[model samples]
Target: MTTTRLPLFPLNTVLFPGLVLPLNVFEPRYRALMADLLELPEDGPRPFGVVAIRDGHEVAPSAVGLPETGKPPELAAGSGFARDDPRRSFHEVGCVADASTIRERPDEEGYEVLATGTTRFRLVSVTAEGPYLTAEVEPLEEVAGEGAGALASGVLRAFRSYQKVLAGANERSLAPGQDLPDDPSVVSYLVAAATMLYTPDKQRLLQAKDTATRLAEELRILRQETAVIGKLPSVPGAEFTVRPTSLN
Candidate 1:
């Protein structure tokens, strides 16, 4: 596998390849991370890694979603170095992302970073303790296997059922008619992103070594969640959530 040095961003969330991540960049350390990233050659993709904070803080007072997600409670918490807390550190596996746009925050106090997921990587070693974390990482991919046949179709059906149950449980979701990607790897990552799962659970999916194995896990999780939803009493006026579903 190929390896490269990547600047790191630790957050309270999990990111999946082919998904978009919007971040509130306010701390001085991360501000430096953003600046260094901007200096990279624009001729090719400039990507950074995002690893879930297993025990530490995001190192920024702000961890806002896009304007639509509203402000989460964590945004209001304290900001500091991620490693200041004795128990804080990042997970070893993470996704690399390419920033599509970086704009100054409306208040002009910080910046908003909008990035699309590019690839996944596993940390080989830490090269920088911080201004922000940096590390050597090996790129990861699903073990190449045949795709898009009966196994895939069954997985797709399970995903649909999972989404239906999830929409009923939640208040909103992506729209219909648009279909899932035929690439098994892409579908697995996309489904991992959309599913309501714990950060560790999502991380487990991220570390899966093969698309076929990931699909099996995805189908199992979807079925498990769906069955849980199946036993719940129906809401009188509940509707399937609808918005654009395609991550691409």
Candidate 2:
């Protein structure tokens, strides 16, 4: 029920709780974000809101030398930059992430950050008055809804079956030897992250109302995907790897 302010980072991918995100931050705006996180108290958690981009590019066009008019040249021409409504560029529901490690590249181009998703939040408002986007968000509760434990068990079995099918099709392990967690919420998120679903599908999983809801949906998805993969002649290569907000 409580609301909090967080720096916002919009990317093309969706993040789920307990999933680790590795970011290659080279954009000026995001590089600034990394610098701010590096300045946080070493012992305290450095958190940010990571929302998926609804439209437009994650890397913005250079706005330098453009007149400070009502719209930037790209906005006026409709071809130079992203959408004018910054708020519309990103999804409203997102995950909260904690930066565990931030290392500066040798060339100082940007930072290589390792972060893990922690929780979910609904965006209330976004502001661009600073170097990067920031938002006021209401935290989403991690409720273990009715029959979550049973649903979790079903999901795990379905996921194992999915992994086998996917491996046969793709000839690769998603993450071999990774011990799957047992807590319902953890299981829900872990499956959501590890699954090879599209970004929209993953976002839907992240936005599920509770653990049981997510598990139920995942159970259906796993079965559906496994069946489809089992029928496939061969699977194409996919980018399986799966980013932070602003600072003043």
Root-mean-square deviation of every model: 5.7, 7.0
Off by over 4 Å in 2: 60-85, 171-177, 234-248
User: Candidate 1: global Cα-lDDT?
Assistant: 0.68
What tens digits encode model 1's per-residue C-alpha lDDT throughout 83-144?
34422466778899998777777865567888998888887865444566677889986574
**Model 1, runs deviating above 4 Å:** 65-88, 146-149, 235-248
lDDT of each: 0.68, 0.74
Q: What TM-score does prediction 1 earn?
A: 0.80
Which consecutive 10 residues in model 1 have the weakest lDDT in total?
239-248
| Top candidate, metric TM-score | 2
Best by lDDT: 2
Question: Residue 32 deviation, candidate 1, in Å?
Answer: 1.2
